[model samples]
Target: MFAIVRRHPANIAWIALNVALLIVVAGLLVAGSRVSVTGYYSEAAWNWMAGQSMYDTTGTGFLYLPHSAIAYIPFAVQAHPQGDVAWRIISLILFVLGCYRFFRLSPQKSEFFNLSAGFVALLLCADCMRNGQATVIMTATMLLAIDAIRRENWHLCTWLLMLGFAVKPLSIVLILLVGALYAPMRWRLGVGIIVLALVPFAFQSPDYVWQQYEEFGLCLFHSNRIGYEKWWAQLFGMLKAFGLEVPDSIQTASRLLCAVGTLAICFVLKQKLDSKRFLVWLYTLTAIYLMLFNPRTENCTYCVLGPALGLFYAEALCGRRWFAAGSMMALAVVILGSFELGQHITPQGVPPVWLAPLACCFFTLYAAFRLTSELNRLEPPPSREAQPVLE
Candidate 1:
């Protein structure tokens, strides 16, 4: 069955063409002519082109970096109502493409596995698209970057990572992780690319760019202090929701400790394994960490974890079948039941929050521990042994 699918690229292309048409029609039906915050992205783009700052106080203010506005420029130039719909439609397309790219780059070899992973990935992204969030674009950027890393295309990897970083600064963590895997050589290149990417923005407005950095930090600080509903889904907010009074000081300390501990474990694993094995663990772990540790991780941000979850599930199933079933149950709880579960636990008028992602949190750590268990005896991980299904 899988072989038949593989042999028919023409069939796949035709299916894709029909799917794209359906996506456009569906987007038009669901979105209508309403312009949401994604329009603010276009607003920021137009304003930037007019010599105004990207972070100006207009229409829900663009929280992204200056370079990120460049991506919205094409849509921004379109007329108002059309531009708004165009942005959403483009975002929808990116979500589909991102899923396809993720499956292709993933370690799930069979077409059935790839198709299943793609389905799960899109299901995970459903909320993100409904809200017209840029998280899908960020997901695509990460998927392509991972594919580049697998091909050892260091320059392509650097550029893709930068593109994502411009939208979601948390992506820098993944960039740093990749840098470590390739060590001194790739590290220099990755860092250099980041620095050079900033150079173009600096040329646009050196002083304003610096000030935008301050504004960006202040924005993050304010959002953290607010403790929004989405924040409740993250480490600090989860603690608070569980009746633990985590002060700002403790929260800061806890985040630092966890981040350092995660990195330390990854570094030790790197020493024990070669590039391929190390990358598999590194990418999966870092994806989870980006959402787990950060206070800004909203429901939409959870879309980024879809690929990591798929990778972990594949690895688990290949190893201990029972463990695979358990993880799937946990994931089903997260994907299907988390919202209602969160609503039942919280009071009226409060945003829905869930503790199920915490299950994923623990599973990530367990996966890392399993991967790095033989640090004392440095032989390659057992042949055909199930590591993370990350390419």
Candidate 2:
């Protein structure tokens, strides 16, 4: 079935055209002067350059690592409206760079599949740019890290992963995922990331850096109450939103279930850790885990799932028919969940129903189940025909 897609180059071009149209339509929807989460980063950089404490900034707290504030200084120096536009443009570039890196690492046999997968991913994540969030940059660094690992560039991978963690501490788990995949290189990766992370702060003010780190920790602890509802707060949040009572023990139950499930999956795929298929599966699962298990995940944060889904769909089309079907179902779940159609699921009565909580939760479990099943299958994946020699 997919051979027809591979034979025709025009299909790839059509996919590219649709991607451009989606971007244009979404851009029109968000073309106003609304200040997004990125405004806080820009404001923090300006404050830090003025010798004011980043933690003391009024609007949204400068919750990221001190290095992020230092890096944003260039964007901050730009005058008013231009800085905002420049930051968005830079972020969009980073997003495209990340997509390009992923394709380079996993060069598929079918351009149609690759281009279409990426188009679907971009369509799903257009809002990340609209909101001027940092997820796109963090996601791009993650792709770079994956590409570095594929090429066995240990130092570059460590540096990219550390930059991601510096931008958003939740990405520390992704660092751990990298360690698990390349166990032998873990020590070198760990040391390089930590050293690079601290250099910016050490050069500035050691005492002030210490203070800001402490404040950052405290801010994270209380972030759930900051008013804006997270898109992926998991089962407990969903249950509470549906007006069901949740006990303190629900937290313990949730952790135990996740731990048990993770262990079972490891047991099943324990022998395939070194295979290319396992690597792709692990990458997708890790990204999905970040979305599902994080304490606070906004709609913008879900953009990280883009590459993961694209990888899954591309692989599935390469002869794993069941896997391909599962990937399409997961994609549908993601889009349905994104519609904000179930706001009645919230404690406060709001309009624009948001089903993300339910849909994301279902899709997360579904992907894990499908991955485990794929790992346990006895037959090897299908092989492709080699390209013919030119006459």
Name the candidate that leads on TM-score: 2
RMSD of each: 7.5, 8.3
Worst 10 residues of 2 by lDDT: 224-233
How many angstroms is residue 218 displaced in model 2 relative to the true structure, after the best TM-score fit?
1.5
For 97-123, candidate 1 gives per-residue lDDT tens digits of 554555554455654455445445555
TM-scores for all candidates: the values are 0.77, 0.78
lDDT of 2 by residue, 204-231 (tens): 6777677766766676655644423432
lDDT agreement of model 2 with the native:
0.63
Q: With candidate 1 superimposed using the best TM-score fit, by how many Å does residue 121's alpha carbon deviate from the native?
A: 1.6
* Candidate 1: residue pairs that collide: none
How many pairs in model 2 have backbone atoms within 3 A of each other, for residues 3 or more apart or on separate chains, i.e. clashes?
A: 8
